[model samples]
Target: MPPGVPLSPPPPSALANPESLTRRSHRFQPKSIWPVAILAMFVMLAIVGIKAYRSLSQNPAQSEQTVEQEARLPVRVTRAETGLAQKWVFDDGIVWPVKRRVLTFQAEGDIQAIAKINGRDLRAGDVVTKGQVLATIDSRRQRSAIDTANADVEVAVQQRNQAQATVVQAQASLDRAKSDLELAKTELVRYQELFDQGVISESDRDVYLNQVDQAEAALRSAEQDVRSAEDGVRSAEAQITAAQARVTETNVDLEDTQLVAPIDGVVAYINIREGEYWDAQRLNSGSDQDLIESAPIILVNPQDIEVEIEIQADEANEIDPGQLTYVVLEEDVSAAQAAGASNQDLLEIAQDNGSRGTVFSVSPTQTPGSRGTQVSIRGFSSAQNLR
Candidate 1:
């Protein structure tokens, strides 16, 4: 120990007194102060977090209430109860003809006349009546043929007359032959009697018998000639009949050279013009080739028109031919006008007033590009006026 340093009391020996050293270290160190400070900080933070969460939760309701107060304003509305038929439906469609006909020619020839012009305005779709000359063909050749046939018929008539005269001559010749045979038989009998009485020579009697045989052969030959003449007359008569029939046929052909309308209708189409060669029964060139054989040369549509619709098979079964129905032309007519009107009103007004129509028809096949059935609505021109 240094002088002047009063040796502090000898330091306690931790090895000898471990418990005393521990107590001294413990007294100098803080035991619970740090734990208490940390706990207080945690409590302060918890309180602050609770207060913030409550304020955030209540803010949305306060903002919503303020907005609702500001939004209270004024508005206006209109009221009208328009009547509508509940049973009606609407479908799209196109207008088409109810009845149509076509015209054509019977014989091959050049067309000389055309009474109806293309695009000609017609009244009531009226058409030319049967036998009405629609066009004429160049009939020079046909006329010549008819003349030839007529001449042949005249010649046949003359020949038939000649045949009849021959038949009469044959009858006369047959009568004469019979008389000659009778006379020869009587002469032969007389000669035989003379020979038996010995009033004539035997050679003379034989000569008389020979004369009788010759006369009989001549009569037989005349009778055969008459029969041949009669056969000739029959043949001439048959020729006359055939000639007459040919004349009749040629006349018919000549008449056919004139093209005529077989029905009465408005000319809807015209395929030929005056001076145009309309070769009948031949395929037309260019655009006219599509004409059907039974088609008329002119197309005439009847006054009546009908609408067709394609509907699904299932829905179509519910419709009957005469079933009553209404149509709503939503796009064509105003809703106000259509409301409260009967189904018949749509049709009647359409016809008389040219109003848009609201009459409908149902069909049996599904409409294209649609999932359900199709229906057609008919409208009169009058109905179109109810726009």
Candidate 2:
């Protein structure tokens, strides 16, 4: 009567009755070639045959009934799954420039003048390029020194010229004296010849010889004067060289007066105002006190920024380079915490609005006078991100 109940095949004697088979077909003529009873019997036969084969193939210890009972047993179910892991670190930090420098003077002087660019006086917050002068030191003294040196060099050059002229005059005098000496010798020889022929007195011969001696003495004096003149020329030349060296030094000092920007950046500070002296000696005290006394006169930096974070040592250990980070303002974080936001909620909020960064570096040791380790986070500024 049930849809899936099993039935058996008919005996061979029932199949042998051809007239009975025809009667069965006619009994369900509206259904099909076979009567409903015979069709039911065929379906039942297929089911029974499959069960018989299953029973034969099954192990003796594992019956069909036992397998069915085990499958029917109830199981206590629960939901369980795995998902991606993430860790969030919450902290506060101060913002900083990604790259920056503090400008200081090497040579000390009074801040006499500051550079002007395109008719504008350079000051803090002004953008500058490499080699662009920032400010000028007092160079009035240097200029004066240079002038004095130039005058000294000119005087030396004049003296050298005068000594050279003196040498020339001495040489001319020496030449005249040589000619006189030759004439005197010739006269003396003539006198000696006349004396031999009794044509002149011995006193006349003595006069010519005395004249020759005077001419020779004058020649020696002229030669000595020439050497002295040459020495004067050389001394003057040496003085000129010394004066020229002084001029070079003054020029270098003048160049140092102009404080040029070493790199392209904004002028973040100017410690010395006009007329303020930057003492080179203050830096030599070998103490921290001098650091402020001789600190940089200017500070400069790029637009990219960073933040320094102080986090618990345990949490800091988990952090590594390239790990994702977010920097929310300290005030904002405090406010969020005061409002009772959950850590998860706070993280979600920061992720949405805070600047994205990464763990750029982590301090190997804890910060001085601080228990927590310091971490450096670098990120693009909000303004840059908008672009």
The best candidate in terms of TM-score: 1
Task: Report the number of backbone clashes for model 2.
Answer: 0
* Model 2 lDDT, full chain set: 0.75
Instruction: In model 2, state the lDDT of residue 293.
Output: 46
Q: Which stretches of candidate 2 lie over 4 Å from their true place?
A: 1-109, 116-125, 262-269, 281-387
State in Å the error of residue 130, model 2.
4.4
Provide backbone clash counts, one per model.
30, 0
Q: After superposition, how far is residue 74 of candidate 2 from its true place, in Å?
A: 49
Error at 151, model 2, angstroms: 1.2
Model 1 C-alpha lDDT per residue in residues 225-317, reported as the tens digit of each score = 778777877877787788878878887777777656665656655556566666644544333225533233555454544454554566566
lDDT by residue for model 2 over 138-253, one digit each (tens)?
A: 77888998999999999999999999999999889888988998998999888889988988888887888899899999989988988999999999999999999999998887
lDDT of each: 0.62, 0.75
